[model samples]
Target: MDTSSTPRSAVVLGAGIAGLAMARVLHDFFDAVVLVEPHPLPADDRPRGGVPQAHHIHGLTARGLDLMEELFPGLDRELEDAGTPRLDHGRDVLTCFPTGNAPRVDTDLGSRLSSRALMEARIRGRVLALPNVEPRTGLRVTGLVTDAARSAVRAVATDDGGTVPGDLVVDTTGRFSRLPRRLADAGFPTPPTRTIDAGVGYASGLFEAPDQSWLALIQPTVCPDRTRGAYIGKLEGSRWMVTLVGACGDHPPADQEGFRAFADRLDNPVVAAFLAEARPVSPLHRYVRTENHRTDYHRMPAWPDRFLVAGDAVCAFNPLYGQGIGVALEQALLLRSLLAARTGRSTPSGPVGVAGVAELTGLAREFQRRLPRTTGYAWRMSTFQDAIWARHRAGRTTRRDRAVTWYLDRLYRAAAADPATAATFARVFQRAAPPTALLGPRVLLRILRGG
Candidate 1:
């Protein structure tokens, strides 16, 4: 299965952040990479047909920014040159967690906040610059083409009956991917799935803000009785992106008055006051696809040899946690590491690392198995609060739920009173440290002492 002579080819589905990142990594490992997209991509930072939430606020977590910089060198500088300032999480940003306003002690955790389209454009430009990569836009992936044995994906069939053949295929087609149906059609077992539907909805819009120095003012919806929240973040082009969010079937109205009313419902009056005076730059865009869904591909007894799934196609989390981009970048980095280790490449690029189609079987399975572990903490962090809110509304709470609720309540109080505990909280929230770090003996003692 050595791919020493003939160059290895790869077909990556979708042209969103995940797809672009995957294609970039594959370009380093394969001889040729073909990125297929269903929509015609614009050259500028404009919303495309595929991403409905493009106008919404998107934060590149500290970890996500680091990974982006690693993948495309000088990306941080490029963003800064474009007038995107990196704000310190504690010093420059105001965060109102569910437990009330988080303590704003200066810390190293921070990220560059920008509209999704702008960030995507920068990454997309870098990805397309790779000589080994080519993008196929305006082509829908119908299904996967397998070899005679039907065990490995040999090519991807497009909507027009054309097939793009490749040595390997990766699916980054986002949440609405047809991969499950395609796999079932190929006589392969579909993966097990789990979902926690928060029933959250939001209305996002752009506004002209005089202030352009800070990052964001976030007030997330608290649990129990509170169901409304707001986020006002600095976007490119000297505009502000304001989003009013509600969960558990409470949707922000798309109309101007309704949007203002929703913003007013937030605990903080700052958002509503600002919206009252700030000039609206865009119509209120409503989005309702906020659910935590995960497909356990690792549990499948059999997997296609040359096929794999990443990003939202595998695990889509609630947007409130701001972990989507971070998780996607981490997944791409993981894919690169797996390929490099398998190919024995000193670095990501050089000679083709994969030996043959047979080798892909193990790599695909291993990747799927390891992918769940990467997203477990993030998934838990998102679903836990949503579950608490859901159960609070239903008036049905289990012992475990009460225990978790009690522990978190005390933890948040401790974080507000103690700087060290607050830093630990920020570390975990930024994904620099594991969640277990917050549950340690010292943190528990701090909570017991009523910090």
Candidate 2:
């Protein structure tokens, strides 16, 4: 490694949202940044072979939209130009609470709804246009190149018969990353991992929308006997992305007729109506691997100095909550800030370079600290809800369970009638506001007043 180089070199593994965003941020500090992906990059909005979830619906929450705007200025306009639908979360979405049917409240917080492929394609285009960023598709990283002491990653060995050397390496390989095992093989201890499985499954299908600009309806079901939920959203090109989800023992079937029956069972008639009117553009895509998994690599006593993991590789959450893209964007911003702090103070070759290493380690630790709080909250909430539903299905209910369910019924009814309460729920959904906000005095008053 030549410290005298005018700018640093960075290698980012995986060409997903996290990898692309990290490469964009790395370009600010490093002279060159390389992004490696396994599949051939798509030249248009067509799906790539890499991301299996591209067929599923993806929602950019209000908070995620804000983060995306900061990362890529004018991204909203770009998405709009590309036919992505902009939705007012409270206004456009008619949310049906489990307790009872109430008049839907129209609030103002907005979210952008689009196909995962379209959103990724837009971001990938901008990232590839960066002068210092190069995207190399169809090349897979087989192993890490380490020094004689095997203490630091000197480069990465790829299937393409070449070594891509850099000052740092980041693994953004999603949930299937082998970086942790690779690091352990290279002499580091295996990192601590935690996983919570709720046995949730997803079935998604694409259809042509009846209207061009109307927001898609999302109906969340809480069948104590079934523990199922469904979501529908409008995607680019006037297409509807509908996903039917189930937790615990209630699973959506992969067969077309069975999936339609599941959608018809939803508390709301909108999903069934849309399915009847719209023709399926693709086969029913099913995914049953939804689990909350996280690795504490930064907590390791002796992690490789030049390597770190980000995105789903660090923490993968249940996609039902739609936190994947938002978390990836936040990780990219954090990485950018850490690198900027290092570059602002000293040249790449100056001093011991110890300070840069320390800064990077601290950034990794900060991310690890936040990981549990983010993923754990969703994991607990989902599992707890699912457990309650399971018990209800089994015909066993304690007094405490009955009381809690009653309170939640009241809260949902209040949320539908009160704008302030609805906003609080929206914030929590977006991960922009803490769960404590739901307990605020104003919201409590509404719940008490029978709103």
Candidate 3:
């Protein structure tokens, strides 16, 4: 154990899933970990103002579930014991993508269906149990305090005129993070931002799960032709989470009849059929701010040492893709790996060297530089679809990438009719494989011959 190399403390902003995960990761490297939240966290899986989308349907992708299980062993068992519905990606979900319905078959990919609030609560519970972790509630982070040179963050300034000092600060404050503003105020250049707004929105509600063999149903709309979609899935407490989505000026209605009518108008009537017979347990909750945004902190000419941003603060994708939590989990995993390498504590024998600002500066820069690579694929997939609708709505022709687009259309059609193709594409959609897998010789041959 190299106590001299270990940092005294680490501070994390935002007590959501990302924040909690950050705290847990920091616990392995720092002597003390403090998690600050603006609101008091509930002990149970109840809706909170901080996360409006919590009312909507949410699930962990296969990769996300795997990461959670790695970070918190027995996580799947814990959720199952709590009555959460487990979904075998290929067997349990009936998906109707714009291409076609994915064939039903056996798959090794795993997913869990539950409310975001519940997942957050479970993860937070594990983080709070760590002896070195402290959860501070009802305190807003007003700004980050820097040293005289403003080269590194030394502490977090709270709204109550107080400060929490730490050797490292990780900002998981989500899409509305103010770290950029703080940096600008401190005479530092803010990271450049990129956004692709499809003008999409969602209206969600909780209802009793329909009597069906499948655990979930999805009917997504095709671009240019249709702009509405629906999803109905089982959640804990024997209830179902239903979300109706509309894009590019086709917003869903919040009223009972309108919501039902909207669902009925999806590409398929699966969601509408379930809503027809299901009993509503909650009001229609609407969320309109669905946009893909990214802060390019990695490209900044100069970033303060010991300050890092992850989760939604770094990249927020279109919620329709179900990649937010998954991306956040991957980001946390990346951070852990980065920290492990710098500390030389490869098997957790004991605490590694205390990382001073000088030691962490290079790591921070490297992390930001490499962070985009991790999110690039998901961003491309989600934004590509959104851009299709965006161009269609604007009466502009889609930019032609003849080889790629033509090949994908062919592949999608093949997947609808071929079980093997469906499973292969499913892996890409679930992020189990890289997009290049579709370019393999055999798959390309099938598409070339119009299989």
Every candidate's CA RMSD: 2.2, 4.0, 2.7
lDDT of each: 0.81, 0.74, 0.80
Off by over 4 Å in 1: 1-5, 97-100, 212-214, 350-361, 393-395, 449-451
Clashes of each: 3, 0, 4
Candidate 2 lDDT by residue in tens digits, 1-451:
6435335678999988888888877776666788888888898878878687898889987888998998888988999998887887766776666644334455556778888888888899988888878888888888888888776787889897998887888889998789887886678788888766656788898887586323756555453444677888888788888888887657788778899888777766656667778888888898988777878876788756577688899888777777788878887877766666655642222122222344444444455455454455445545445456545656666777777666666778887777678767776776667777877898778878875
**What local lDDT does model 2 show for residue 28?**
69
lDDT by residue for model 3 (133-162), tens: 888888998888888988788898999999
Residue 113 in model 2: shift from native, Å? Answer: 0.5
Model 1, span 91-146: residue lDDT tens: 67666665656667778986898888888899998888888888898899888888
TM-score of candidate 3 against the unseen true structure: 0.93
Q: How many residue pairs clash in model 2?
A: 0
Q: Put the candidates in TM-score order, highest first.
A: 1, 3, 2
Residue 413 in model 2: lDDT: 83
Model 2 poorest ten-residue lDDT run = 346-355
Candidate 3 lDDT: 0.80
